[model samples]
Target: MRATIIHGAGDVRIETVPDPVILEPTDAIVRIVRACICGSDLHPFHNKPAGSDPRAIGHEFIGVVEDTGSAVRTVSRGDFVIAPFVWSDGTCEFCREGLFTSCLHGGDWGDENVGGGQGEATRVPQADGTLIPVPGITEDSELLPSLLTLSDVYGTGYHAAITAGVRPGETVVVIGDGAVGLLAVLSAKQLGAEKIILMGRHEARTNLGREFGATDVVSARGEEGIAQVRELSGGHGAHRVLEAVGFLPAYEQALGVVRPGGAISRVGVPQYVEAPAGRVLFRPNVTLTGGVAPVRKYIDTLLPLVLDGTVNPGRVFDMTVSIEDVPSGYVAMDERRALKVLVKP
Candidate 1:
């Protein structure tokens, strides 16, 4: 089998690797039908120190179950499924509470022993808990792209909106226009936010944001952007700010545009450590929420919508690449030439 490996920053390659097998009774082997590059994958692509050992990469995918371990009864071989970025046991306390990302026995893909999603196949741990079997939909359905988003981006955007407590008629300011950010705009719309302000510089992507429900697009940064959002929201700032770019500047913008009692939900996979937590959050009584989305928890809730055509979050994928060209996929996204890259193995 061939898989993607990250040797270092700006370095990704496809090479022949050993095929994965079911190691645990709860595991399943999924043959990749659709996979894609995630914005979070860029964190290591940009900052990973040189001279580090190479490792398998990629985490978002929808595939067909090729095999399963003895304990896997929820799904059988040949079942179409969506694998969340992380695998967790459904029996854990955290999983029962809808936080599968923190399950006691959960783990991520693309590790030394685990196969990456951008490959011919992958070994999925805790199959019953991590893989969401798609019913009434074939692998060749037109909804594959939309179903694929349930793996990470869509569920993640939904997480930010839910965590921020977006309500009907409330105003929302979404920072960043990446796939996650654009989908955050979609999430806000689905939650009934009357006003949606999307902050991004790219006109093409921001245009899609408009189609997703953004009533306004602020391309400015720093103070200018803050002022634009404030003016748009009638001077009190937005009721909710969703920060989808995992950078200091985006977070600062979130802090600047949120109303005094509003919330800032960050789901961009924070790239900074020490953030302004004193005067900004103290006197304002702003609530800071959002983290790695427990996508598994939201898949069931979002799948029906995708199937019913109420949303089209897959619009975020603007480019497609073969497994051998995944390196270029990374470059396209890193240089902002593509919003997201869909991989076909």
Candidate 2:
């Protein structure tokens, strides 16, 4: 079997690895049909420690079940499925509350012995609890990109908007215009936000944001960007702010644009520690919240929309490549030449 391995920073390679097998009663072996590079994958791609072992890379995929453990009754052989980035058993207290990301027995794709999403096939523990079956489509369909996003991206963007409490007729500002950010703009509008100001400079991508429901695009940065949003919002700033970029500057910009009593929902895979508590926090009364999206919780709620064509978040994928060309897929995204890359295995 062939899959991706990260040898060190900037060193991603396709290599032959042993095929995975069911190791637990709750496990299943899924054959990859499609997978893709995520922005979060870039962090370790650029910052992985030197001399580190070649570890599996990628955490978003949609695949077919080749085999299932005896305990796995939720899905059977040959069922198409989407696995959230984090794997969990459905029986935990947190899972019961739809917080599967924090399930007592849950873990992520890259942690320790677990394999990741970018490969020919991988072992999925807690199959009954972790995999979401796609009914009516047993094989790849035209809805592939949209279904693929249920693994991480679209669900994440939806999380940011829901956490921020976007309201009908509210003016919202979304920081960043990457795939997730653009989808965040889409999410805001779907939630009934009347005016969406998307902050990004890339003409091509921001133009796509307009198609996604961004009423305004602010190309400015720093205080200039803040002022533009304020001007659009009549000097009080936006009623809600969605921080789709996880860096310090983007985080601060989200802070600067949100109105008093408004909230900031961030889901861009944080790169900084200790969100800077700024001086304006007290005077304007801004609330901050968001964490690893409970994508499993959102999968069912958003799947019907994707199937019915009410929303097609798959447009975020601007580049598509063969699975063997995965490294170039990463390069295209890292260089900003592609908004997102879709890989067919």
Candidate 3:
């Protein structure tokens, strides 16, 4: 079996690795058909120490189930499924409450001792809870990107909008233009936001954002960008703001562009800085919410949209590469040359 492995900072290689097998009663083994490089993968790809033993490097994938453990009932051999980036035990209290990302037994792949889905074959634990079966979707290769979106980006985007409580006729501002940001724009429109403002400089991405339903695109950076968002909302700021980029600047922009009493749904994975609570707590009743997206919760809601052609989140995919060429895929995305990269194994 072959898998993309990150040997160290800026180094990625496709190498042979042992095939996976079902290891738990709730596990399933999947033969990878398609996978993609996530923005999160770049954190380690650029900052992790050099010489760190190569680890499998992808989380988003769609595949055919080759085998399943005795406890797996929702999926079976030969079923086509989408693997959520986070694996969870469906029986947990948190999972029952629609927060599978925080499930008591949920964990991320590609961590120490965890087998990642970025290979020829990989193990999926709690298969019945983590994998979403896509009925009648086996032969369509083009559907791979959209199905893959459910694993992370699209789900996260949906999370941002939902967290912000976007409503019909509300003005929403989405910060960042990564895959998640672009999808946030799509999600806001689908949720009935009458005005969608996207803050990004890249023409390619901002253009796609418009096609996805962004009513306005703000190309200014920093304070200028914040001002543009406010201007679009009649100098009152948006009623809802979606923070899709997890960084201090992006966070500040989200806060600065939302009206008092509005909500800021932050889906970006915070890296090092803590948000200034005082700014939010003391000023206007601003509601703050968000974390890792509970992808499993949105699988049912989003799958039907994809199936019915009401949304095509796959438009964010600007490049497609072979699994062996994943190194370049990562570089392309990291450098902003590609909005999203899909890998075919």
Candidate 4:
């Protein structure tokens, strides 16, 4: 089988690799149908340490179950399913509490000898807990792109809004206009936020944010961007701030634009260890929250909405590529020429 491997920063390649088989009774082997490049994947593409062994990459995928281990009960061979970025045992205490990302037995793809999603197939641990079956939809349905988003970005964006406690008629500010940020705007709107200010420099991407429910677009950065968001929120800053870019500067913008007593929810994987925690957070009684989205927990909530056409998170995928061209997909996203790239294996 052919799979994607990252030899080092800016070096992604497609090469032949061994096919996957069940290593645990809870596992399933899924033949890839649709997969995608995530914004988080770019972090490693940009700064992965040199001289490390090449490893399989990619996490978001939708596939058909080719086989399942003896212990798998929720899905059978030939079932169409969505694989969350991480696999967790459904029986874990954290999973039961809707925090599958923190499950005691959970782990991410491309580690512990698991095949990555951007391949011919992958071994999905905790099959019953991690793979969500898609009913009544064909493999080629236009909704596949939307269903694919449930694997990560849509669920992640929703996590940002939900964690911040977005409510009806509240003011919300979403930082960034990437896939997650645009979807965060949609998520805030779904939660009934009456005003949404999207901070993004790209006019094309920000335009999508507007359609997603952003009442205003702030193209400036630093103090200027913060000022624009504050003015749009009627001078008090936003009731909730969703930071989708992982950089510290984006976090600082969130800190600047959130009103006192408001919350900041960050779905981006943090790129820094230390951030100002003194007066920036203490003076306002601000609540800082959000982490890796337990997307498995959100699949049920978001799947129905996709099936019903209430939302079209698939719009985030502006480019599609064959498995052999995945390296170019990464470059397109890294260069900001594409919002998100969909992969067809």
Candidate 5:
């Protein structure tokens, strides 16, 4: 088996690793078919603390079940399935309410001695709750990219829009132009946003945003960008703002373009923690809410669209490489030379 590992900043390698096996009664082993380098993965790729040991990387993948533990009854061997970036016990109260990210028993890949997804295979704990069977499965490699997005990216973009409370015929502005941000534009339109404004400067990426449903693309930055959005919204800010980039500047831009009473739904992993509530969040009377998306909760609502070809988030994969070339995938994404990278095992 081979897996991607990150030894420290700017250092990634594909090394032969031990094959995974079911270690718990509820575990399942999945032979990796497709995986991806996420925008969030770049955080640690470029910012991991110096002198950290090499650890397995990547969390998005879709594959066929090689085997399942005795307690795994919902899915059987040879079933094609997708697992969320995080693992959780479906019986938790928060999971019942569609907030699996906050489940009482939830964790992620690459921890607890679990093999990561961007590899030849992975051992998934809580298989009954974490691994979802892909409906009407066939071995069509073309469908892999789309199903792979359902594992995290599309579901995450869907989360940003849903939490923002995007409404039909309303004005919505999405910040950031990464894969998730581009998909956020698409999700907003699906939810019936009549006017979708995307704040991104990259010509190539913004072009896709327009194709995804962005009626307007604002290339300005700072207050200039905010002004452009305000003008497009007829002097008032957007009815809803989706912050898909978690940096302070991105967060600030989201607040800048949201209507006084509108909401900001963020899905990007926050790089900096918010300070104690202060004047910045007070004067506007706007709602600020978002956290790690409970991707498992939204998979059902999103899978049908992918399976039926209603939406194709797979377009974001600008580059693809063999699983062993994983380090270059990181480089391509980090340099913005690629919108997103896909790996085939």
Candidate 6:
């Protein structure tokens, strides 16, 4: 089987690797049909040590079930499914509370010795709990992108809006124009937000953001960006602000653009950074929350929206490539030539 592996910083290759097999009664083996390069993958690509082992990379994927273990009942062989980026035991306390990402038994696919998304096939633990079956669209070609989004980006975007409590006629500001950020704009609109403000400089993405439902686009960067958001909201700031880029600046921007009593939903995969506790805890009644998206929880809710054509998350894919060309895919995204890269195995 062929998979994408990173041998070191800036080194990405497609090579043959051992196929995965079911390892637990709740596990399922999937033959990946499509996958995408996530922004998080770029962190290790640029910062990993020079001598790190060539490891599989990728976390978002949609595929067909090749095999399932005895405990798997929600999915079966030949069923098309989407694997949430985070794997969880559905019976865990956190999972029961709909916090699958924080499930006591939750685990990431490609971390340390675990294999990742850049693969021909992979084993998914807790299959019944993590894989969301795509009903009645077993042969739909366009379903791939929608299915793949369930793994991360779209789910995270939905998480951002929901966590912030976006409501009809309320104003929402999305910081960042990355795939997840753009999807956050979409999520806000779908949830009935009357005004969606997107802060970004890229014309391609900001344009897509408008098509998705951004009522306004602020191309300014830095403090100028924050000012533009405030101006749009008549100095009150937005009722809900989504921080989709996981960094200090973006986080700060989200905090700066929300109303005194509004909420900031951060779905960005945080790196080594800290937020000012004094500012967040004392300034206004701001509610700060968000983490890795509970993708499994949103999968069922989003699937129907995709199937009905009410939402088209696939628009986020600005470039498409074969899995063998994943290195270039990474380059395209990192260089800002692509919004999101879709890779087919």
Structure candidate 1, residue pairs in collision: none
- Tell me how far the alpha carbon of residue 151 in candidate 3 is from the true structure, in angstroms, after superposition: 1.1
Model 2, 1-345: lDDT tens digits are: 888888888888898988888888889999988888998888888898879877988889999999998888999988999989989999999999999999999898856666778888889989988999997775558899999989988888889899999989999999999988998899899999999999999999999999999999999999999999999998989888888888889988988898998888888878888867776676678888788999999988899999999999998898998878989988888899999899888
Error of 4 at 323 (Å): 0.2
lDDT string for model 5 (1-345, tens) is: 899888899988899988898898899999988999999999998898878877888899999999999999888999999989998878889888988878788787888578787899999888898889986677675778989998888999999999999999999999999999999999999999999999998999999999999999999979999999999998989989999988989988887898988998988988887643465567777888877988898888988898888888999999999998999889999999999999997
TM-score for candidate 6, residues paired by index: 0.96
> Which RMSD values do the candidates have, in order?
0.8, 1.1, 1.3, 0.8, 1.2, 1.5
Candidate 1, residues 56-134, lDDT tens digits: the string is 8999999999999999989999999999988888888999999999999888897657888989999998899889898
Candidate 4 at 41: error in angstroms?
A: 0.6
Query: Compared with the true structure, what per-residue lDDT tens digits does model 4 show for residues 1-345?
Result: 999999899999999998899999999999999999999999889988888988899999998999999999999999999999888898889999999999999898999679888888999989998999887667889998999999999999999999999999999999999999999999999999999999999999999999989999999999999988888889999999999999999999999999999999999999999998888898889999999999988888889999999999999999999999999999999999999999999
lDDT, residue 171, model 4: 97
Candidate 4, which segments miss by more than 4 Å at Cα? none
The true-versus-predicted C-alpha distance at residue 81 of model 4, in Å, is 0.3
The residue ranges of model 6 lying beyond 4 angstroms of the native Cα positions read: 112-114
lDDT of 6 by residue, 19-114 (tens): 888777888999888889998888888888888766778988888999999988999999988888888888888999899988897688876544
Candidate 3 lDDT over residue span 9-97, tens digit each:
99888888777877789999988888888888888888878876778778888899999999899999999999989889888999999
For model 3 the TM-score comes to: 0.97
Local lDDT at 238 for model 3: 91
Which pairs in model 6 have colliding backbones?
none
lDDT of model number 5:
0.89
After TM-score superposition, the amount by which residue 276's alpha carbon in candidate 1 deviates from its true location, in angstroms, is 0.6
Two-way TM-score contest, 4 vs 5, winner: 4
